[model samples]
Target: MLTPKQARFVEEYLIDMNATRAAIRAGYSEKTANQQGPRLLEHAEIAAAIDAAKGARSERARIDALWVLQRLVFEAEADLADLFGDNGELLPVEAWPLIWRQGLVQGVEVLELFEGYGADRVHIGRLRKIKLDSRVKRIELIGKHIGVNAFRENVHHTGLDALGDRLERALKRNH
Candidate 1:
């Protein structure tokens, strides 16, 4: 798991921009992108992990990216409070209930909407922790995913649909 700083550095450099600028944006000192980035990048495994983690996943399934990213940051800094008990999941205790409740709501919605589709425990579990942002970002990133066509396109409807669809599906699944 790469730290947020490390993730930021890679995401930027991968943009094909100047290395120094990318490094500075990542909060490194004095043209350190060359020295810092390459060293971190050398952890090829970490790079692959970040790539897989950073791919275009839905906001319904990825809103927690920042949470996970922060967790990774905590792991990197070795500063996570022992709040999640001995289980080693790096989330705060107080936030879990609220988060899980939201996740349940999302799962029900998904199951309902995907009525013809089957949603097992594991799949729902994975989908539940997906951040609210995951859905939102799926809409936003659609433009970034496609190159020139992105500029020509805009997506106001995706947001509306995610909300309505998720809710409608949840209600249907309840029955």
Candidate 2:
């Protein structure tokens, strides 16, 4: 049971998950939307409604954590060799495996080669550069998904007591 405005806010929030923008779009005053948005989220009923909507959307899209992890793993393990032939020439897009073509390749740049300039220009050949998605980045994401801090550096912290002890030791040495 939501008021029309609240319902509208929920709908707009689903569009981008930007609560303040959603509040403004739902007819709230822009000046107060920054406060109003988070306050609305604090309501148990509103939170429940948002959760239900998210669950429904996830179900409709057939996407879950496992699905995302699988995709990340595929991208992380993508092989560059798959994009080239035994002769060491880059394969055409049609020849590339479907998974690599769809998920690994980020973009392609083509440079048309020509001889001469102006009207005398003759088409020679083309140079293609294929940009692949960052495998290291994908691996890092997979590590994060599985709760492995593979890419994170260990941070060591010294307590105040430890610092005090070190200072006393230094003072004794000086004395």
Highest lDDT: which candidate? 2
Model 1 misplacement above 4 A: 17-20, 53-175
CA RMSD of all predictions:
24.3, 7.0
Clash pairs, candidate 2, are none
- Per-model lDDT: 0.52, 0.89
Query: What TM-score would each prediction reach against the true structure?
Result: 0.26, 0.77
lDDT of 1 by residue, 65-160 (tens): 566555333333332233245675535435544434433223222221232344542332222132222433443444444443544556565588
Worst 10 residues of 1 by lDDT: 124-133
Off by over 4 Å in 2: 115-125, 152-175
How many residue pairs collide in each prediction? 12, 0
Q: TM-score for candidate 1, please give it.
A: 0.26
Model 2 C-alpha lDDT versus the unseen true structure: 0.89
